[model samples]
Target: MSSSQLPVRAAGNLRSDAGRNRAEIVSAARAVFTEAGTDVPTSRIARRAGVAVATLYRRFPTREALVEAAFADQHADCSRFFSVVEQHPEPWPALRTALRRFCAEQARDKGFTAHLLAACLQGRAPAGAAATSALEAERLTALVRRARDSGAMRPDVGLTELHLLVAGNAGVVAASPPDQAAAASRRFVELFLRSLEVPRRSGAGDGVR
Candidate 1:
């Protein structure tokens, strides 16, 4: 090949190699975070991806950036789930499905769950994630109002309580043995949902919130 053509070919190869290395690093980071946690060292991820630590760093400048990329699918799924729930015609069913699906995901994906919880608590999520969270929160508020208006939920129930329910259940799922977490999460959500129902009273307490 001519000298000029050689440099162009070399650049093309470099781009291809960089793309492959970035994908490997992201895949490795996801697996490592799943088996261990985000706290695992970057060197471990590099070793798993069969790339140098410098390569990993070149692709993802910060640990959080790697985490954001690794969990990007989970984040997109959650965003889509919330959008679906927002469109459901029935508020109660939407609430129930949202809780069940969210908890199930939390149990199945501990790494994603960890990042989600941290993002919510620390206000440090990526821009896209933060927008999703805000959108979900707004939809949740509307859902809660609809549920209360329909008498499916108690008058005293509010949006903050729903947040607490998800956050608390996420912790339960995170703390349980991986094998049993899904079942446990389902049971917990069922109990919480039942508790939110407006009760039929027999006396003067009938209207109590």
Candidate 2:
């Protein structure tokens, strides 16, 4: 190869290798965080990724960076759920589905639960991460407003109340043993939904009590 061409090819190879390492580190972080919590040492993730600690550090820089990158999939899933909620014509069912699905997912993934709870507690997230979270919050607020306007939900509820609901659900997921977490979260969400709903006009109760 010509000298110029050789340098270009070398640069391309380095880029490819960097991409591969980033992907592996993210994949390994997901598995490691799932098996353990987010607080586990970064060396474990580097070990799982089959990379040197310095390599992992070069890619992620910090634990939160790795956690944020590892959680991109779950973040997308949450956005999808919000989109579904936004599209549904029936507000109550949409709200119910969103809560149930989100909480259930949280229960099933302790790593996600830890990530979410930590984000909530910290009150600030990395810029891109914070943007997605803010968009989710805004979408949920709109949904809740629509539900309230439809008289399907209590009129007094707002984003603050929804935040509390989510926090409580996260707590349930955090407290339950892994095997039982899903069921417990489901039950809690069901009860919470029932409490939030407006009663039917027919005076025939829907067994919420």
Candidate 3:
């Protein structure tokens, strides 16, 4: 999902209309940002959204505000994504499926992708926490719950640690080639998950580092 910022004229209007227009702008901005990257001018965002530049400014007075709003929408989208995962038969495979989709998105989209890098600079590029940024930390929380229940992921693993892992992997996959990066990223997840597993019974020899 993408969001666009409103221009000046779009702002200072009726409250409900202003709110609706702002929401529309955000949706447009999300698409534009994803297609054009954050470098794309906010004017372009307004044009893409079919709103006047003044309207864009009226709604979002600053680039940072627009950026934050777009990121938040992406986060909301992520929360909705959990609905898809809930359909899965179990959690481990479900987590893998989610990660695979994430890898694909990171590899393809520019706006949302750049957001990942921005996270490193404390730019707060959206990473599945915008909407739920308040109380729900579903992605990492789900992964940790599944891991702990599996007796595979270290019981010590928690939401923060898992979120970091997800963020790190997204950054890595985003920089990778668009075609095969999803497969490669999924491999990374698989290996990580495998490493968390309890050791097999000593079939033959003691484990080696």
Candidate 4:
């Protein structure tokens, strides 16, 4: 019938446009939600996207749905986090860079879905709760193992320890002064690494030292 529909059907450009528009909506929603909270107003998101509230509803039927999508999107961004392991092919530097980004993201995004951020004040924002944690931990353990086997890491640093450290520092990132927070990750990582390094003592007794 209409030329638009015909060409879209033929070239499939219509689907591409729809996908791009949906992504834009999600991106906008994520931006507002991260800065705001889980209870962010629907109209706020729509206004930010320069779209109608109906468009926002069409893309995300519910607040929980939008929150889940935003959480997933945040996790997806993790893969692209810079890893020196991928470049210099070592583990500690990669861990340093990755953990630094993790700290930054925790400070930046602590919506009602960011688990393990010590967001107890927010009371643990579990988007998909157990399911998401299970899926995410699987991926994290794999990365940890890879780094450990590469010999740039200590054998004791497992996923649980990693999670604890991230959780511990996330709050510091949030409450500390801006300039101090900016360097918190590097400083924390350095101290943690130093603690993890091989213990060398000029003279020490196992029970007394």
Name the regions of candidate 1 deviating beyond 4 angstroms: 1-9, 118-128, 174-177, 200-209
User: Where does candidate 3 have its weakest 10-residue lDDT segment?
Assistant: 120-129
> How does candidate 4 score on lDDT?
0.62
Q: For model 3, how does the per-residue alpha-carbon lDDT over 143-184 read when each residue is reduced to its tens digit?
A: 548757876456775655445555666666766786767777
Q: Which stretches of candidate 4 lie over 4 Å from their true place?
A: 1-24, 37-43, 50-54, 63-77, 81-88, 111-136, 149-152, 200-209
Write one digit per residue (lDDT tens) for candidate 2, span 60-85. 88776787899889889888878777
Across 158-192, the per-residue lDDT of candidate 1 in tens digits comes to 86576677787877887789788888889888888
- Ordered list by lDDT, greatest first: 1, 2, 3, 4
* Cα shift from native, residue 160, model 1 (Å): 4.0
TM-score against truth, every candidate: 0.77, 0.77, 0.57, 0.59
In model 2, state the lDDT of residue 32: 83
The TM-score of predicted model 1 comes to 0.77
* Overall lDDT per candidate, in order of appearance: 0.77, 0.76, 0.66, 0.62
Give Cα distance to truth, residue 103, candidate 2, Å: 0.4
RMSD of each: 4.2, 4.7, 9.0, 6.8
